[model samples]
Target: MTGTDERPDAFARTDDGVSVAYQCRGDEAGRPLVLLAGQANNHHWWDGVREDFHGTARTITLDYRGTGASDAPRDGYSTPRFADDVVGVLDALGIERADVYGTSMGGRVAQWVAARHPERVRRLVLGCTSPGGPLAVERDASVRRALAQPDPDAVRQTLTELMYSPGWIAEHPVPYGTLGDPGMPPHARRGHLVASNRHDAWNALPSVVAPTLILHGDQDRLTPPENVPLLAARIPDARAHLLPGARHAYFEEHREAAGALVREFLG
Candidate 1:
């Protein structure tokens, strides 16, 4: 299935009154796969790789409360809460269970989902993420400073450079825009940042019963490649894979290989 069969964008109201926006595509009869985006990113974050699962999985993507078309509430921003929002979306769509693939902040949220709601996840794929808390390896201060540039354009440029290799960026230049939802308000963006920073799933990871695959780019500086093993060690049934010469956006930069790996694991 493709464009013709894609479901229209819809809203799933969370218990807290935030209406999360989601869309479904790919094979309607195929196994369901939920693609969770990074912090602050909306459903569009999966646009580049979603098609890779077209024939084998019914792909579902959604905008978290503070991003995309979802309502941006002033509070209730945390990784665990984000996980609950995902469950709410599934409940609204009448989906009982699904395979889940999450990258960056989404990966953190996925950890909580599998831990807190094991019955809702058949399999899990965590890409470019960490276990959070003090045990997790953090990026260098320089990388943090670069990303914290006051100018949005500078921050975007820094992110683009950090996410992809120079050759890839030159070959496919991205337009000037925020890496996440461009329309995200200051409060919402801040909420996302805080939520991402506060994520600590170390204690809960051992409770994840779903088989897991951890992917990371060896060259990643934003999330650091070191966190992959930390995650693999915590999850009961998990394996880790690293992509050489890839950065934070390895899933996009190496979509073919990444997609193939995810397909095989989910199958």
Candidate 2:
């Protein structure tokens, strides 16, 4: 059986009147490690590393606007608005600077955090994320087809193809029944995906000054492994980790290995 959706330990109200949903784990006195989740994912991505890093850092995971426990804005989402929401979360929590850990679309925000408000970021860790929209949003036919399909079953099956590694599927195949029950609501998931697809940052990647760690699965189908070399070469102080046999969900596909790598990189 699948698990119930988890709740954050505490929530801070944002200036937009939306409640920025978040969970804090580890020592309250530790350095801040804020998790910015990717599109179609909430704080759930941190399930493996949350507790492990909590002792070393005050780990926090946030549900961006229109995703997870965060309020869905009526007008909808874009990179700028999403960036504002991140600022709002930090403001409410009284955090001045933080080590940002972002995945997929969350990584995009981390990029903006360094670009627009460089002072807010202490360091950044981006996983399976692209630099911007042009190459970022170009969808593969099959994945796009699945998103447009009316049947939820079809979409879930399609996403699984891009999300896990062949080795993972071979040994720990996901149960088809529970796979596509997305964490975010249906309408919101589509909006989040829309925001992710349309985001373009190629013109601005060079401006990022904060130290960055970029990790991608060599076998990634969605973002593709090529992006690893491409992103690392451009962003100054950026390092890339191309993990073999890993896929889109690098953390979940190789949780233990990823955990050790992250601890060292973040420390």
Candidate 3:
């Protein structure tokens, strides 16, 4: 089961009357770590590695406005909007500051938060993401086709293929039957896609005062690994970690290594 399945659901009301869904785990000690998932994912994306942080930090996983149990409005899906939702979650939970980790499009959201609200973020971790603009690398045709798939099952299957390395997928296969639950709606997914495509953080990276870490899979097809160096170069105090032979789901496939790297970086 995923983390969301094991943890109780909670809601944080955004200023604009939207309810952002989240799940909090781990102990009350150390800085809180907020996890933001990819374009089409929810809190469950952290299921494989979240428990590794149980004793190290308070881990909070949130769903984007248009995904999961979060309130999906007709519009308003931007990186800044998502960043505000992050602040809303923290405010509702009475958390003053947090170390934020985001993947894919969520990484773009994290960039906005770190840039716009420097004091709210203690540190930032971005994985399998890019500094969107003309400078960023493009996704392969197959990957683009997969992301644009409308059917839930088709999307999940295509996503699985794009995420993991063939070797990893073969050794530890996913149970496709239990993949997507309460899948994202077509309109919401489209909103997320548009927001991601329009995100441009190249100019804002230098303003992100938080110590940043960029993690990418060397074999990542959706978000090219080439963007890693560009992100690290732009962020004032940033470093990059590229996992060899790994794909988009490197964090889940190499949970132990990724968890250790994150813990060390946060400390």
**Each prediction's Cα lDDT score?**
0.90, 0.72, 0.84
Model 2: lDDT to the true structure? 0.72
Alpha carbon lDDT at 81, candidate 2: 66
For candidate 3, write residues 102-130 as lDDT tens digits.
98888999999999999999999999999
- Show model 2 residue runs off by greater than 4 Å: 1-9, 135-139, 170-186
The worst-scoring run of ten residues by lDDT in candidate 3 lies at 173-182
What's the TM for model 1? 0.97
Those runs of model 3 whose alpha carbons end farther than 4 Å from true positions after fitting are 1-7, 145-155, 176-182
- Candidate 2's TM-score: 0.87
Candidate 1 worst ten-residue window by lDDT:
172-181
Better of 1 and 3 by TM-score: 1
For each candidate, give its TM-score against the true structure: 0.97, 0.87, 0.91
The RMSD of every model to the true structure, in order and in angstroms, is 1.4, 3.8, 2.7
Candidate 1 per-residue lDDT over residues 139-196, each given as its tens digit: 9999999988899889888999988889988898775222778888899989999999
Residue 75 alpha-carbon offset, candidate 2, angstroms: 1.8
